[model samples]
Target: MRIDLTNIPSEGKSLHFTLTPDWWKSDLDEDRLMGLEAPLSASIKLYPAGKKIAVEGSLSTRLVMRCDRCLEPYGWDLSTDFRIYLSIAPFKGELDVELSEDDLSLDFIDGEFLDPAQIIREQIILSVPMKTLCRKDCKGLCPVCGCNLNMTRCSCSSTYETSLYQNS
Candidate 1:
């Protein structure tokens, strides 16, 4: 939803919004989030300051991820919280400098309607974790016997969970 800052308060205005999962386009990362089969849900607050908008909120969703050690699909929960500022000032020849959000600085965009879908895409991408695990001591599938060691036993001298990291 677009927040027209034409006549907002100087001290900023408090606004709350909830966005559903259907608002986003599917951006599946085959490598991450397992098979990339889930969408993010958003709850946010906006504080408008002149032509600047400060956003803070959280998005939660369920992810199907591959077990880092076993290569099996597992259910993983993911959530992303964001606190960022965006400037919606009109472009004038008076200033031609690049904008940034470093160290809680500033980011500039066209002084037009803001697309909520774009905001969601950015938030979701930034929230993904670099690494994920099924469990701290997950006994993954057996390599030799092709059995899920966590659920079944293997007779062959197949690799075990504890042995996988013995060298490390």
Candidate 2:
């Protein structure tokens, strides 16, 4: 989503974007985000100041996730509110900033325009979970018998303990 600076108010800019499920359904190498869908609506808030803009917004959508226990594919809703700073450059080396946060990285743009789509894609990727599970009590498939204990209910819960030397 590209916001024209002329449309922004002097005080602040507020935009309401209707992001459909198809927006996330792109041909990009979304393998990491495969099966993730964004069939929902979201809003973005813009605060523009001196060739720079601060963005904050929230979005909720269904995304693909793997079951942490059984390693199965599952779809679920993910909600996240992100804040970022964007800048449009009129000339090269025109933007600079001093570090204040413990871990803050700056990305400089040499273009005269700003595209929020790139930032949105980055935020979506960062928002994904490293590990997902259908439930906390999920019992994965048996290692030897190859049976999902959560569904099979076998009495093979006993396994070798590698921490036997820790107590000694």
Candidate 3:
């Protein structure tokens, strides 16, 4: 999904589209997003601002992910509304110039085209949680017998459990 910013009007153009599971290939190394449980719907409005462009939109989708603890599959719902300002002109300042606070979120356009796929991929990556668990109270697996604690209780003495977390 590329948007040509060369002829964008001052009032901007509003566009709406859907991203299906077949549209994108996962590039994550580990704990990757398996697929989309529902279609991803996006609505964006691009407008010209000076030598830059402003992008504002919202995207929502339900993703299938693998649990880090039990390695089981699960569904996670994600939705985000983003506002970004892009600059098409190159910065001619010195190489050693220090960045201001506003430079943190500023984006640069490439050849008068705005690649929405890159933006969507970045947003999805940022939205991923550091830790993925099926549930907060997940008992996990038994260290001795490798039994799922959530399913069945192991006969390994309770002392083993007490000693495991004592040092931590």
Candidate 4:
């Protein structure tokens, strides 16, 4: 997973690898909201740009995502391309320096080693949707009975007053 910068040839270096669900399970935290339904295919190309390294890659996989509304597991196909610039030199500027638009795409590295696994992991995590839903009209779970409304109707009263703005 770690590539030595010095080993990269003058022209460039290309890497291809398959990341399994087990890899993600071990890398991700205990509260991970997503799972890999299939092995992820990754392709990366590294180019040396003076003191900086340019990484371009693509990832494709099937992910098992939990729907936020229904709390059900659903399959989602993922395919995305990414480009990252790595600066080998550490910035010596002031800590309070403002970042420009170009600086947003740049990453700083301490040593000559690059961990592609970490980059792939980050890309996968960033691809997760903020609001996950299995369907557009998910009924969700009943507040009182905790029953999935999408499956069956609960006998609990549906009319409930909002207590959030109530004067206490």
lDDT agreement with native, every candidate: 0.56, 0.58, 0.68, 0.70
TM-score of each: 0.60, 0.64, 0.76, 0.77
Ranking by lDDT: 4, 3, 2, 1
**What lDDT does candidate 4 reach at residue 27?**
32
User: Candidates 1 and 3: which is better by lDDT?
Assistant: 3
Model 1, 71: alpha-carbon shift in Å? 3.1
Off by over 4 Å in 4: 26-32, 90-110, 160-168
TM-score of 4: 0.77
- lDDT of candidate 2 over 1-168, digit per residue (tens): 555643467677666655665566443533445555556556677677666677777776787766755666667787788877665545662444332343333432323333555445556666767756666666666655666666775555446111322322
Reference-based TM-score, model 3: 0.76
lDDT of 1 by residue, 71-158 (tens): 6778777677777665544754121222243322112222444444455556655555665667877676676776877778878674
Error of 4 at 101 (Å): 10
Give the Cα error of residue 54 in candidate 1, in Å: 1.3
CA error at residue 17 for candidate 1, angstroms: 5.2
Candidate 4 lowest-lDDT run of ten: 93-102
lDDT per residue (tens digit) for residues 85-113 in model 4: 66554554211212223323223232566
Maximum-TM-score candidate: 4
Error of 4 at 97 (Å): 16
The Cα RMSD of model 3 versus the native structure comes to 4.8
What count of clashes does model 1 give? 0
Residue pairs in candidate 1 whose N, alpha carbon or C atoms collide under 3 angstroms? none
Clashes by residue pair, model 3? none
